[model samples]
Target: MILQGNDPTTGASFTLGNRLQRQLWQCVWLCLFRPSPRPLHAWRAALLRLFGARLGPHVHIYPGVKIWAPWQLSVGGHSGVADGVTLYNMAPIEIGAYCVVSQGAHLCTGSHDYNSANFQLVAHPIVLASHVWICAEAFVSPGVSLAEGAVVAPRSVVTRSLRTPWTVYAGIPARPISTRTRHGTAPD
Candidate 1:
């Protein structure tokens, strides 16, 4: 018998209609979003909003940021997604007010179930609490929650929830190393 190449173990995947809808959205993202001129944050935000993203005032989504499923995203006021940040939100992703997701940071909410024969799709929501800072190129895994005022150091890989508020985390499988008490974090 010839191999059909279809995985039977994956019971019920994305239907034809769902695939088509995603294709349409991809086209919109490629045509209208990827080509949008730089620094026009308002335009970008408006486009995301049109796509059903719940964004508060002053939410800055820079050009070149890839937002998969904007409808599942929620960004509070004064939050920013810097250039080249990829928010792969197969599940919901909430960025609270006063948060900054720096350049190249990747917030991924989708993963395949390794134990499943068909490698079924699975997802978990990510929550970045208020006043948090996800530094450049940080990789935040699915189901991770960065507490309020938490600081993820540059290039860190956060695998689990950061429960303590106001702490600095660094290194792979990020570990909190210090308590962050910033009284005006500005160059003196």
Candidate 2:
């Protein structure tokens, strides 16, 4: 399981150490990461790496991107997370190589179970396969996995996995809208 404490009534959702680390990270974000210039993608990536994020070479994470729990994040080579993107990765969020997450996009990996009496906290991993493109302001929900070359239209919401590779999806529920031509093979 990606999450630990389900019931907040029993105790805090995260452990004390986790909470402390988050606090420290928040401070660093405010003081260093957030204030850095726009062109300093490597600097921001280094900061995220310090927090335990597994990022490959040439990954571009803009200064305005908000990342919750960098430890649970892994972004592959040549992936670009644009400005105003939010990665709410309560669980692990693995982004494959050559992916583009456009500005204002949101990837969420945690939610509350409304059916549960205690309002249990549940989380799942989000995986974006290589060559995936999430357009501006798109929302990818928990447990979603976008196949290789999948494209999510702007402002669309994805609840389930997009199983078909090289397809484009749009609308509230993000149904398949069109097909895209696949490019080269997997990167070395």
Candidate 3:
């Protein structure tokens, strides 16, 4: 589905330019210096901001995080998007306050339209609500939403809507593993 609020031409340009810039920066950093935990965060954030990323207060973006378009990323206050996380957002990617996108998680907000002869591109928005945790190696596909406090376990492939709050989702094409408190306690 064509996502609303994204102009096709503008989105294309943004995607292309942002990808090139990110790649250049990545190469430079990797070649020149090793990925150190210290100083990289500030440096990366500056680069992202230069590319028009709408980052809110105290957002901690670790090294090795790949963002397709900084202009397409909208991170709310105090969010932590960890290392090796890839945000392939051809459209908008909105991460709400205090969300934790753990290491190696992929948030893909764009895909190719297979039905068309030319293989037209299609993009969608990904929304993650406050306090959500996308665990390591989890994949959140186009247009998916992780409700507030939802937890996606490691290596889970989330291919559908996750509307339940404070629930644990696990496995490939993730299903609700259980409904429980944030600490994994059974609900009373």
Candidate 4:
């Protein structure tokens, strides 16, 4: 769950970049990405790039996916975000080439500081290196970076950065379950 700074329930407590920019984006998203079909990945990527996202070649963004701020999202070439993915990128969320973000996954770059009385908004960047796969329904916490070739099992919750690449992780607060090996020049 996220404690959004721009939450209507919280009133105007945090900044969502510029008001004019956000308004413009809302219009574009509503008319373009939101209503577009799932196969229109190229169109979605182009729209996101036009809004300041550093999208690489062949980045596939599904129509059902929701990106809070396109400018704060970056995806490398051949990386695909499956349907039902949510990018709550209050900060930056960078994904390297050849990575796949599965359906129902949430890449959240923002969180609330529970210790604070105001539940102050805290943000951190999320980086997913090349050949990484975050399985369905996984929750990637703020500031967590997944190294190259890492596999986050379905429904896993990653709360910390995993420096070791080519490993399989599972369970809540995901931990390394085993080392993954690639098969014949492709990812494991």
Candidate 5:
């Protein structure tokens, strides 16, 4: 939740409970989640589920991935979040079925309002529709939603929502480069 009147620069942006939970999660992540073998996707998924994350069957979340809050994350069936991906979900982040988030991709749901004198904390949810693919090193900004079958090219930055399904986006501020042809089996 965005702290409407709180000054992020001087005061705490999140509740005490929230801060404690994150600290505990960090310990677990360092000890249990980070050192696991790469093939142990199910093990990591179980750890995430234990923290209240809603993950569907066969979702492969690599051990190297960093999730700010697992409880605020949800991944649909057969989706894969590759190694080095950072899910900074201050708010909820939802990844639809059959999606792929490649290595080094960052999905951020929190930011500070630059215009505010106190640097107010702000947050919004990020949504990746079914069959969406975020290529390696892509940066998805807060509140951005990618349509079904939308693909973000490697190293691209997405500041706005990608409304066109089956489209491929590229460049710094990602723009539609080509319309992709969708072909994929339904997640069981």
Candidate 6:
């Protein structure tokens, strides 16, 4: 897919670069002022929007939710990014409608190339499908996908893809813990 907010070929553009700088400024504001919960949350979301975050309707992002670059983050309708969640999105991060990113969760979207002489950087996108629940303290590494209706339990570290719908995933380098309906009932 064409990664939103980035030129797939050149991977760089003046507009995108300027937006990235603006996002960093917003992060600085968040770190310095430490505004109250409600207003802070709203302001931060607004800042993200200003920098090209294509958030659909009713996206709630709490204060203490850190985003590396707004240009790299997109949230679909009715999504919730909870407090203390950090999105290290040096690359694109796409969240589908109704996704819930719980408190303290981390979505890391970039890494350094250890073999490179200058330790060059590399980035990959993280995609979360509709109705996914990333539980509190969970981490999603770069290039991972959490498919629709997938529930990642608290403290889980997801390194691989979770493609099946309505599956529960837990533990470090998260694995499927169980499978159930969206309402939590096991399928017959």
RMSD of 3: 5.6
The TM-scores of all predictions, comma-separated, are 0.89, 0.93, 0.78, 0.89, 0.96, 0.80
Give the clashing residue pairs of candidate 3, or none: none
Candidate 6 residue-wise lDDT, 68-131, digit = tens? 7777889988889988899988789999888899999999987756665544567799999888
- lDDT score of residue 151 within candidate 2: 97
lDDT head-to-head 2 vs 5, winner: 5
Cα-based RMSD of candidate 2: 2.0
Off by over 4 Å in 6: 1-24, 31-36, 39-43, 183-188
* Cα error of candidate 1 at position 173, Å: 0.8
Scored by Cα lDDT, where does model 2 land? Answer: 0.92
- RMSD to the native, candidate 6? 6.0
TM-score of 5: 0.96
Q: Model 3, poorest ten-residue lDDT window?
A: 1-10
lDDT by residue (65-157, candidate 2, tens digit) is: 999899999999999999999999989999999999999999999999888776778899999999999999999999999999999999999
In the range 39-71, model 1's lDDT, one tens digit per residue, is: 788888888888889998888888788888888
Q: Comparing candidate 4 with candidate 5, which one achieves the higher lDDT? A: 5
lDDT scores in order = 0.86, 0.92, 0.79, 0.87, 0.93, 0.80
Return whichever of 2 and 6 wins on TM-score: 2
Q: Worst ten-residue run, lDDT, model 4? A: 1-10
Ranking by lDDT: 5, 2, 4, 1, 6, 3
TM-score-wise, the better of 4 and 5 is 5
- Cα error, residue 17 of model 5, in Å, equals 0.2
Question: Tens digits of per-residue lDDT for model 4 on 1-188?
Answer: 23454544556555444555777888888898889987888899889989999987888888888888888888988899998999988789999999999999999998778877667778899999999999999999999999999999999999999999889999998999999887643432
lDDT of 1: 0.86
